[model samples]
Target: MQTELSKRLGVEYAVFGFTPFPAVAAAISRAGGLGVLGAVRYTAPDDLARDLDWIEAHADGRPYGLDVVMPAKKVEGATEADVEAMIPEGHRRFVTETLARYGVPELAPGEAAGWRITGWMEQVARSQLDVALDHPIRLLANALGSPPADVIARAHERGVLVAALAGSARHARKHQEAGIDIVVAQGYEAGGHTGDIASMVLTPEVVEAVDPLPVLAAGGIGSGPQVAAAFSLGAQGVWLGSVWLTTTEADLHSPALTRKLLAAGSGDTVRSRALTGKPARQLRTEWTEAWDDADGPGTLPMPLQGLLVAEAVSRIQKYEVDPLLGTPVGQIVGRMNSERSVQAVFDDLTRGFERAVDRVNRIAGRSAR
Candidate 1:
């Protein structure tokens, strides 16, 4: 699993683990890989700082990173309330009707929504970046695209490498031009927000498009064999997200959702705009179906769609609405059949990677090392 990127980041493997939980992030770093904490979940600066403090204390002197979701250009003067105003009355009616039809209960009296929608805002994301740069983070990545060139320069000034997620060769070239140190080729099969290209076609194209810039292959990767394949495609590393959701360290907060993920096959996931307004792959549920319905109000874009669904998402998870309850996940869900510790998953990946390498060696008329 060793590669130039791994060695440069002081990790034993060229695996970059992206997860929302601090425990999982620290565990990945401790397991000889770079753990990147997704920053979009942290809307408050103090909360992000607090979690970074925890990761630093528990990371065993290993390196970790932060992944923030912000648009390439700054979005100005767009408050949450302003975004909320843009949601049509029909969209609101649709959400209300869907929840009522599903028999999903509303939040209990005085119960907070349990989630906030400010993380995607430029102001909030900038606060996150401020806290992250103050920490000992080794890498700073943008989940949406390349942050402004000034942001990249800021990361470089602090001696932290900047990376961005790109779905196409053109996007990779853009990131490279923006001075991004690395580019993660996140394909259509990936969870959360992603693009239309599959990993097989996207990875090599990105690697070649940004030659001399390190590339991490993402999407539909969960095992050592997949890691080997990533390297064979000229990737300096592999970036993974969905494979971590079922880890014992993960806190998905809903047992029913976990069961749904475990039971899913590669064919079970669909790329829909239900989760984040963008085309993101997730479990196909009645929720997605409603939005995808021809007669229903179509989904909104970016912050608008996110704001529209925030309360409904909260209710769905709070009450565990079976048909409407689902989270972002990738096609790799088929292999995540049971809960396992982060360490155990890493062991499987390394062992599988070794076997894959040996198989390849034999195929080339050589013995296993």
Candidate 2:
């Protein structure tokens, strides 16, 4: 069904699936939903080129988009090299020691090289934007904040629709000022980096604040009823992230993490700043618990903290020793019990939406009678 969002993006459905995996992106697009691939960690232009090319080939000509992080603030006068230098030696040592305590070992030879961390710098993000612009991406989404004026101007030049995520009405206004096409009113219940407000509260506030600018409801939206609620609240579509992580096509192959996600309930996740410097919702694990410990060394600032823990996080994943090594996720993980194909998930959602709408109409009819 074509909603205002579909019309705006020239897509077939208003269901927007976001992921870091290229295959997932292609699959969602092919399944009649818009697929958005997160390119935050893409450093080398060629890497992005290859990923986009792969998505284009596999997408069956269905439209897709790309996401990048453009934080509204940064350390003063910090160049890429300078940011890299700011990563403390003590933080690195702590990461290494923590991993060792958990029985995760150092990366082996070529493995370490392949897992090298990149793209946490401003220049690197800009470089990624340059590469993305050269392609035929239909939509460009900024995660952390509104994009730079130059980025917006350049995307407009190429006819790419720009979207940004906002946690509050204030942020929605800022996105409007930045000339963004869509505002994802992500609530505190959303996975990854999120704000303090719940979806039901944030969605209407953002919609009212940024009148005429389409809003997408995100955060804790995992079912058809949730989607209907979003539309009823005046959202043009829904932005989903955590719901897709447990999909069969997800890149998370680790048995431990998968088990945790499947077994988790809505209350299992927590908002912690252990991964990125910002408060992000993720599964509460031993690693995160350690960070919350009163006696432990506190976390550093954004990119510096990310860089400090990258190598150790890699080791944890390589060893398959723990489920807490990854980044943020939302409380919706509890509902993610099984790994269904992307198309199957979309079908279920569509069916659920229909049922929910029918129920609502019946209730309204009864009230009128």
Question: How much lDDT does each candidate structure score?
Answer: 0.90, 0.83
Number of the top TM-score candidate: 1
Residue 88 of model 1, lDDT score: 95
TM-score of each: 0.98, 0.94
lDDT of 2 by residue, 205-238 (tens): 9999999989989997888888999999989998
Tens digits of per-residue lDDT for model 1, 1-369? 788888988999889999999999999999999999998877789999999999999999999999998876544456888778878999999999999999999898998777777888888998999999999999999988788878888899998999999989999998898889999999888888889999999999999899989999999899999889989999999999999999999999999999999888888888888777888889999999898888888899877788789889999998999988888888898898989999999999999999999999999989889
Once superposed on the true structure, which residue ranges of model 1 sit more than 4 Å away at CA? 73-76
